[model samples]
Target: MTDLSLIRNFSIIAHIDHGKSTLADRLIQITGGLSERELKEQVLDNMDIERERGITIKAQTVRLDYTAKDGKTYELNLMDTPGHVDFAYEVSRSLAACEGALLVVDAAQGVEAQTLANVYQSIEHDHEIVPVINKIDLPAADPDKVKLEIEEVIGLDASEAVLTSAKSGIGIEDVLEAIVTKIPPPSGSRDKPLKAMLVDSWYDPYLGVVILVRVLDGALKKGDQIRFMQGGTQHLVDRVGCMRPKIEQLSEIGPGEIGFITAQIKEVEQARVGDTITTVKNGATEALPGYREPQPVVFCGLFPVDAADFEKLRESIGKLRLNDASFSYEMETSAALGFGFRCGFLGLLHLEIIQERLTREYDLDLITTAPSVVYRIQLGHTKTEDAQEILLHNPADYPDPSRIESIEEPWIKATIYTPDEYLGSILKLCQDRRGIQTDLTYVGGRAQVSYELPLNEVVFDFYDRLKSISRGYASFDYEQIGLREGDLVKMSILVNGDPVDALSMIVHRSVAEDRGRHMCERLKELIPRHLFKIPIQAAIGGKVIARETISALRKDVTAKCYGGDITRKKKLLEKQKKGKAKMREYGNVSIPQEAFIAALRMGEE
Candidate 1:
C-alpha cells in the first residue's frame, strides 16, 4: 500500500493564456491520470467555448495516482482553475479545495495583473505557494529574470522556482516530485463530525446536482442524509464519488478529499456552489468552512425579440442559474424594449456569457440593453438603496433631483501590467477612462500599476484599450471595490429619428458630449439609408450635441435593372420600403445596422 501521507492536494494558478491549461495536460500525462490514447491538450476544460477561446472558464478537479522511483504510490488531487478575473469567485472556491498552489508565470512575459491578484488571493487563503516558470521553450524565455522577480515582488524564494516547458514536457516530472516534497498533505481527523464545504457544482442529467467539495473535517458516505446550510435544505445522499478525472464511484469521502455527492435533488438551488453540505443528524456542530455571500457588480436588461419567446428565455436563464449561483434575475420591463428581466452578474464577461448562452443554447433571439452597474442612492430622509431600485432602466422611471440625496456607483481595484515602453500611452489611456493610479512598481522589465477606477469607467472598453495601447503586450485585471458617489446621467440615442428608450446608459456627464458625437459618427457607418435620410443623435435629457445624417437612398432602385428581371428589382425595393417603416422613424431619417453596432461598441470604449 502507498503511504497516504505523501499524497498532495494542489491547484495550478496563473494569468489567462499563460499556459496553465497546457501545464495541466502535461501533469496529467506524467501521472498516468490520462492515457496516451486519450491525450488532448487542455482536456480538463472540456467545454467547446473553452477550447475555442483558449481559456478555462470553469475549474476542474482530478486525482492522479503516481508511483515514484522509490516505489511509492501517492494520490494527488489537482484542481485546475480559471485564470481570468471574471471568474474570481469561482477561482476562490476552487482554491478552497486545495492546500497548495502552483503559481505559474510566463517566463518571457513575467507576471501579469491577474497573476499578482491570484497570488495575493492564494496567500490570503494561507496556501503554500510553489512557483513554476512556464513556457521556457519560447525564444524569449527568461527564467532567471522571472525567478528573481517572483522572489522580490511576491517574496517567494528564487531557488524554489521550477523552470519548465509544459508544452515540451520538460521539468514536468520534477514538478510532480516537488509537489510531494514541498507541498504539505491535508491535516484533519477523520473521526471529527462530518463537515465539508461545497465549492463548484454541476447538474448532470443522470446524477442530478453533482456537488464538488473539500472535506474540512471527518468523513461522509453514501446513504447519508445531508442538510444544506443554505436555505436550510436537506437531501438523502444516494452516492458519493471521487474524480480520477473519470468519475469513480466511492462508498465514502475522507478528510481533505475533493469529490462529489449526489442526492435525489431535482433542482440545483438546494445545493448551491458555496453552500455547506453536512450530515443531517451527525454533522458538524457549526457550519461548514468557506462560505461566501453572492454579490452582483453589473446588471443588464435582457428582453426577447418575440414576446412568445419570453418564457423560453426565462427557462433558459433558470437552467444557467443552476450552474452559476452568482447570476441572479429579476423581472423588469422598459417601454422601449418591453418585457424583460434585469439580470445581475459579477462582471461584464458574466453578462456576455449569459447572453450568448441564451441565444446559442436556448435558441432565443434577444435584445439586450447596455449593461449598467447598480448605483446606490440615499432617498426619503436618509434611506439608502441601490439606484436600480429607482427603475432607471426606463427613462420615465428615472428619479427627479428632489427624490435623490446622493448617487453612488460601483468602483474597481484595477491593475495593469505591461512592458515599460508602453507606460506613457497606457497612463494616458487610463486617465482618459477616469482611472486613478494609486501605485506603480517594476517587476523585471515590465511595470505594474494599480488604479482605483469607477467600475462604470471600465465597464466598456478598458480591456480593449489596454491591449490596443500596449500592442497586445499588456494585461489587466480588476475586482469590485465598494460603491462611490458619482456624477452620472442617462444618455439616450435617437435611432433614425425616434428615440429607442431601451438603448440608454448611465454615463458620466463630463464625457457625454464627446461620446455622443463619436457614437453618432460610428452609427452613420452602420445604418443604411432606406427611403429617407437618417439622422442619428446622442442626447442627454432632451439636449442633443452631436448628430449624423445618413443620406437618403440615392440609387436604391436603378431606373432600369439592366438586363436583370424587373420583378426581382421591384420586390427588393418593396422590401426596402417595408424595412423603413419597421424602423423607429424619428422625423425623416431611417436608421439601420450602423446605429446598432455603434451602440454595441460604445460599451467597449
Candidate 2:
C-alpha cells in the first residue's frame, strides 16, 4: 500500500461566521490536538487580531492523530482556510496542499456568495468535496433544508452530506470518519529530485522565517540545504517542524507530508507564496505548479497618529512583514503627515488587517489615506504603463496626462448576496454607484446580484454601506475583471481653503458630485477646531461645488485662568497651543487634526 493510505489531508472551508473555525476547534479536540479543558474558541486562529475580530485572516495548517472507531491510528493533515475574498488566493494555495475540502455550510443561512465562490474554486482544484451542514443545534437551523439547497443548487448529492453541530459535539465523530474515508491520501514519489510547494509562511518571535511546505517529491530534514526556486533564494534548513496548531520540532517530513522549514532567512523577499522548494544539491528540472508572486490591487498612504511612532510604525511593519509577506509598501515622507509609507494590499480586508496589526499588535496609532486601485495608462499605441507600478503614490506627484494617453482603473466582477426583500434596494444602490449589473439569480428567497464595479468604487466602505442598506443581510465578494474605459477625474481636497496636493482622489466623473459632498462633510468632521472658520472644499480643476465650514470656535479658549488653580488653565492652554501648532495654518484660519482621521471613519451614516 502507498504511504498515502496511512495519511489523510483535507481543509475546512466556509464563509465568515459560518462556524468553520468553531468546528475546527471541536475537530482538534476530538482528534487529540488539544485537551477538552485546553480548548478555546477559534483556537486555530492564533493571531490576537483574528480572535478580536472573530474572523480568520490567515490560512493555518495543523496535524492531528486520530484513533478510529476501529482503534487504528490515522494521520489528519487539516488546514483552516480564510473566509473572506481578500485572502481567497491564499485559500486556493491552502487547498492545493490538500486532496479534499470539508465544505461547511450554515444550516440557517444557507450558501453565501463567498461560499459559492470557494466551492467553485475547490471544484476547479479537482478536490473531492464533503458537504458538512454546521450549526444544526440552533433553534432556527434546518439541516434538511440546507441539504436540499446543496443538492439542488450546488449539484451535490444530499444523501452523502453529514449534519453537525460543532458546539454540542453532535456528528463530529462522523465528520472525522468522513475525513478518513472521503479524502485521498497524498501520493508522491520520494525517488525524484526534491520538490515541494510553499503554501503559506509566518515568522515566530523565537524562530525566524517559518515556511509551511507541502512535500511533493522528496524527504526534507534539519541541515538540508534548500532553495526557493521562484524567489531565487537559498539557505540551509536550520530546523524541520510540523504544526499542531502551534509549531513543534520534527525529525523529518517526507514526500506526501506537510510541515515547516526554517532557514532563518530575513526579508519577505525570500519567503514567497507558491514558490518551489528544492534540494540545493540535486535540483528539480522544473519548478512546481502554482508559482506566482502576489500582486496587490489597492494602495494607500499611511502615517503615524503621533510622529513619535513614525519610526516604530516602520520597524513594526518590517516585523509584521516577516510574518505576513502579503503586505507591500514603501517608506516615504508626507509634507503634512510627516514620515509614512505608501502601502499596497490585495483588497479592503487586507488594508484593514495591516492597519489593525499596526494599531493593536504593534501598539501604534495611525492615519491612512483613501485607498486607490492600480491604474493602466497608455502613452501611445506602443507605450503602456501600470499606474501602481509606475505612478508615484503621492497625489501631488501624479504625472500630467498631456504626456498624452488614455487611462483605465482596475474593475471587479462583484457578487452581492442579499435577502429577496432587499433586492430592489441593492440594485438601486449599485446603479447609483455606477455599477453595471451582469446577472441576477434567486435562490431560496435570496438574490445573487452580480455587477461589474471599479475596484475604486467598492474599495472604501462600499461593502459596509451595502450591508447597512440591506439591514446587515447582505454579503459581497469580488474578483478582478480587467480594466474598462470610463470618465474619471482627479478630485482634490482644499484644506483651510488651499489645495492640499496629498489628499486628492481619482474617481469616476459621474459619481463626483456625491463623492465630493461626502468627502467635504467627512473632512469637516475630522478637522479640529480652529481660530477662524475653516472651509473644506472638493474641487475639480478650478471648479468647486461642495464645501463645509468648520466654524470659528467661540468658547474653546480659556476665557479666564481664574484662581491660583492657574495650573489647570495653563495645562489647557498648553494643550490647545500644541494642537494649534499641528493644525495647518491658512491665510485666516487654523485647521485641526480630525480632518486627517475623518476619512477612515466614513460610511457610518
Candidate 3:
C-alpha cells in the first residue's frame, strides 16, 4: 500500500483547447504510464465523439507512478477534466476527488472567461492550485503577461507558475515535480471502515457497471460486500483496479487513493456519482457530503424521424443516460412531431453533444426542437398565501395568461472575454438579446465584460452568434442566476390554422413580433407549396402577430379553354377555386422532416 504522504491526487483544469489533455499525454509519457508506441494524443478521451470533437466531455482519471528527483517514488492520481462550461459539473465532481488542480492558461490568449469560472470553482473546493502557462512555444505566447493576468484576475500566486509547451514536451518534468512537492496529499485513515466516494460510473459491456471511486477513510478490496450509502444497494466487489490509461487490477484500494471498483452492479444508475460506498457490515453510520444534483438549464424535444423508431430512440436514450446523469428526459407527444422525449440539459453544447451521440453512437436520426429555458409561472397573485407556481418546461404546456399572475424567466450572469476589435459587435449582440451590462474591465488589450441576460435568449443561437461576431476570439461562460419577472409570452406557429406544438416557444414580449415574423418567413420558404395555399401564422394567445402564405401549385384548370369564351374560362377558374378551398379545409399539411430541422436551426441566416 502506498503511504498517504507519497500520493498526490490532482486534476488538470483549463479553458477549452488550452492544452489540458495534451499536458496529460505528456505527463503519462514521461512517467512511463504507457510505452511510446502505446501513447497517443488524448489517450484519456476514449469516446469517438470526444476525439472527433476535440473536446473532453467526460472527466478521465489515470494513476501514474513517478520517481521524483529526490529518489522517492510517488503515486499520482490525475483527473483530466473538461473545460467547457457545459461540463462544469463534471469538473466540480472531479475536483471534489482531488487535493489540488493544475490551472492551465493559454500563454498567447492570457485568461479567458471559462478559466476564471473554473479557477473560482477550484478555490471554492479549497484546492491548492498550481498555475501552468501552456503553449509557450507559440510565437504569440507571452508567459509574463499571462502570469500577471492570472495573479490579477484569479488572485492566485503565479510567481512559481511553470511555463511549458505541452505539445513539444517542454517543462513536463517541472509540472510533475510541482505536483509531487507543491500539492498536498489527501488525509485519511485506513483503519476506519471502508468509506469511498463514487466519483463517476459508466457502463462497460463486459464488466457491467464500472465505478470510479476515491477512497476517503478506508480500503476497498475484491470480494467485499459493499453498500451504497445513498442507494442502500449492496453488491459483492468483483474487481478493484486503477486505470493507467488502461485498467490494471488491484488487490485493494487504500485510503486517499483513487481507483475503480466493479461490484457486479447490473446498471450504472445503481452506482450513483457522489454516493458514499462502504462495507455492508460495520459500514460508517454517517454518509459523506455528496455532490449537489446537476440542474439542467436548457431543454428541448428529441424525436425520431421515423415514427416506428420511437422505441429504438427510447432505448438509445436510456443507454446514454447510464453514462450521463445530467441529461434528463420525459415522454411527451407533440401534435406535429409525434411521440418523443422532452429532454433537459446543462446548456446548448450539452444538448448538442447528447443529440450527436444519439445519432452517431445509437444510429438514430433525430429531429430536435428549439431549445428553451425553464420558466416559473405563478398561477395566482403573489399576495395569495397558497399561490401556485408551476415550472414551465414546454411552451405548449404554458398556463393561461389570465391565470398566470407573473411569468418569471431564468436569467444568467455571463462573462465574456474578447479582443478589443470585436468588443463592439459582442456588446451589440448582447444588447440585441436584451442583456443588461453588469461590468466591464480591460486586461492587457482584451476586454472582459459581464452581462445579465435571460437564459431563454442565450439558449437559442447566442453562443453561435457570439462566436461568429467575434471571429471565434471571444470566450463565454455563464451561471444561472435566480429568475426575475419578465414580459414573456408563448409564441405559437400555425400551419393552415393548426398550431404546431413543436415550433411553439416562450419568448419575451419585446421581440416576439420580430421573432414571429422571422419564423413565419423561414417556414414559408421551407414548407413545400401544396395543392392549396397554406397560410403560416405566428400567434400569441389569440392575436396573430405575423403571417406568411405559401401559394398553391396551380394545375391551370383553364389551360384548355384558350379558344373558349371569357365566361367559360371564368367558370372553370371559379370551380378550381372552390375545390382549392375544400382541399385547404380537409388536406393535412404533412410537414417534411427537413422543414422542422431547418426551422429549428434559426438565427443562422
The candidate that wins on lDDT is: 3
lDDT of 3 by residue, 137-218 (tens): 9999999999999888888899999999999999999999999989999999988988888888888889988999999998
RMSD of candidate 2 to true structure, Å: 6.6
Q: Kindly list the per-residue Cα lDDT of model 1 for residues 57-93, writing each as its tens digit.
A: 7789898888876788888989998888878878888
Error of 2 at 324 (Å): 1.0
**After superposition, which runs of candidate 3 have C-alpha atoms over 4 Å from their true positions?**
381-387, 562-564
TM-score preference between candidates 2 and 3, better one = 3
Q: After superposition, how far is residue 344 of candidate 3 from its true place, in Å?
A: 1.6
Where does candidate 2 stray beyond 4 Å? 380-394, 521-535, 548-588
Clashes of 1: 8
Sort all candidates by TM-score, best to worst: 3, 2, 1
lDDT of each: 0.79, 0.81, 0.91
Worst 10 residues of 2 by lDDT: 385-394
Task: List, residue by residue over 311-389, the lDDT tens digit for candidate 2.
Answer: 8988988888787778788987766778889988888888888888788887887888778887765554325743333
TM-score of 3: 0.96
Supply the TM-score for candidate 2: 0.90
Clashing pairs in 1: 375-387, 460-603, 460-604, 461-604, 497-586, 498-586, 526-594, 527-594
lDDT of 3 at 144: 95
